[model samples]
Target: MSFYLSLDDVPDLARGAAILGTGGGGDPLIGRLLVEECLKNGKKIEILDPTEIDDDDFVIATAMMGAPTVVVEKVPAGSEAVRSLRALEKHLGKTADATIPMECGGLNSMIPLVVAAEAGIPVVDGDGMGRAFPELQMETFGVYGVSGSPLAVSDENGHTCIVDTGQDNQRMETFARAVTIKMGGAAYIAEYPMSGADVKRTAIRNTVTLALNIGRTLRKAKDKHLDPLAELSAFLKDTIYGHGTVLMRGKIVDVERFVRDGFTQGFATVESFDGGHEMRIQFRNENVIAHKNGAVVAIVPDLITIVDVDLGTPITSEALRFGQRVAVYGISTPAIMRTPEALQVFGPQAFGLHEPWVALEELSAAR
Candidate 1:
């Protein structure tokens, strides 16, 4: 089924995007504001289910490409993504039938909505990555078979570059990162142009709806003065993302994050209120690996998210600070994302972690 989003849904969507982002994908607040601004102008955004698209319909993915930390200080002009989409359309000599999110994390989740509204097009209800990933080539679209090239990168000042790397998605990331850094450490990107058939086959289905549902569940739980974490766990058990586990409930003792190689690279340390336990999560934009009491509790391809203990609102990686009381939750990724082919692109080793990838469920049980 299809649905429409109004201004009222922005907050819920943003909240869920942040959770799914696992501390990356840029700030959801910024993306939320952009979508709100669009809706405030009386424009309605429609979300089309992947199955609704015709086989030949052209779809393009839109997202922010940069250090999430940098995005905290540098808000977008809200037109950068639209510019990149238009530029990509011109380069391909074909207009996009609809826009899809490159990843369903943070700012990237909302970017396609903004672009769809501005371009007067609908958005597909699925994304390349079910959650967030830092690199361009890590998308399931690339993992399954879609080429991310003929990609467009644009900055706030109207400069746009189209990268045609043929089949080299990694090279696309390399070239695009250079342009992103030159554009001031952050830029908007339009990549992975694909047909409706490819989207149906490769894209994770219904994640936009999933994000909205997660947000609604948390919001409702809070409204009822219920345990939001427990509610979130129960809600996720039925989704593609398996279960959610509370890795630690504590205050942040330290956070060491900085923009490195066009990515926000760092670690955050969370200590239990009584100091009985500690968990450290490392990231290259998105939370990749986490250790609790010196043991690997969760690793990449699985979600490592931090949310407010009281409200259950997600905290992005760039926003982590000392003394913030938070609860860290580790959720399993979908089975499709754990396959041998998928792991090679986004698993623990892909992010430079020497340990082999382990399912969050198994790791949590062993602990």
Candidate 2:
């Protein structure tokens, strides 16, 4: 828990984090970059185990909400992350003994580190979601009946709203998204008030260590020109959840993004260079479903990633475009995401697809 991770170690951690995210947390790049910048400025990220805290110590999960697309255009002023957590502490009437990274993907993962450093608290080494997802309530926190209400969200312009929604994490999510859009499409949020024992019961533990291990492995693979994918598969062993072929390779032809019901909804078309197939990828901040050559190929609860094979970098759902020869990879999902409630909120049907929700791995293996 005392280890200080360097900027170079972020990718593997993020990759592993994404797997844990289980197709819900947002992208990890923004989070990695933010953490890296903090380290560059001589900031140190402290990791803590839930057991290290006192039973009654205050703990909170933190993340960002709004359009991931808008975040690139309007970079946070660096202080916005910490501001939301600090504000929440004032509202809760106690100093947070530790800051918990709400989820382990994209910007949310780094939000708490900055808050922790500024507050001089240790950042809990675990997170609510192992991977990324769009909805606030779709986490182990949900599994344990942790309502994501009573949240504090803030924008760069210094607009802060302390919400007390009781049990309506979804409605709270909707409300926060609206405010975030009006404020320019992205804002930081502090949510899920919990204690140490509750933290262990509801959180995914030691993910930071797993992330560090994965990051280190990927770096070694890169240096050795080893097949990063294969190395990862071997390293993960039983944990590789899902795997699938490219289905089809192509450049992105078009993208349609719009904010509705407090979520960014859209899709992209990848015209296969092989000239015989095509891929249609759909998402809501997080990649949820993908189709190939007019055939439904992949669906949520699983992970679909479009990596520039040559660059070994992931393409954000927004940056996906036409004319780039890309390789798409699919990962198996954890069984929990298949829960009816989880799927109703993020499945293929949730994205407006008529196909009955089918797990991607099943379809991929069948192919």
Candidate that would win on lDDT: 1
The lowest-lDDT stretch of 10 consecutive residues in candidate 1 is 68-77
lDDT at 133, model 1: 95
Quality of model 2 by C-alpha lDDT: 0.69
- In the range 1-367, model 2's lDDT, one tens digit per residue, is 4666666666667665554443234556666667777778777777887667777777888777777767767777667867888788888787778888877665666667767756677888877666567777667776677777678889988889887778887787778777777777788888888888778777767666766665566567878988665665566555434343445556767778776665666877777776777788787877777888777787765667676665444576656665666766666555555667666765666556678877765797678
Off by over 4 Å in 2: 11-30, 50-55, 240-248, 259-262, 344-354
Candidate 2, number of clashes: 20
Model 2 worst lDDT window (10 residues): 18-27
Candidate 1 residue 210 C-alpha distance from true site, Å:
0.6
Model 2, residue 4: C-alpha shift (Å):
2.8
Error of 1 at 44 (Å): 1.7
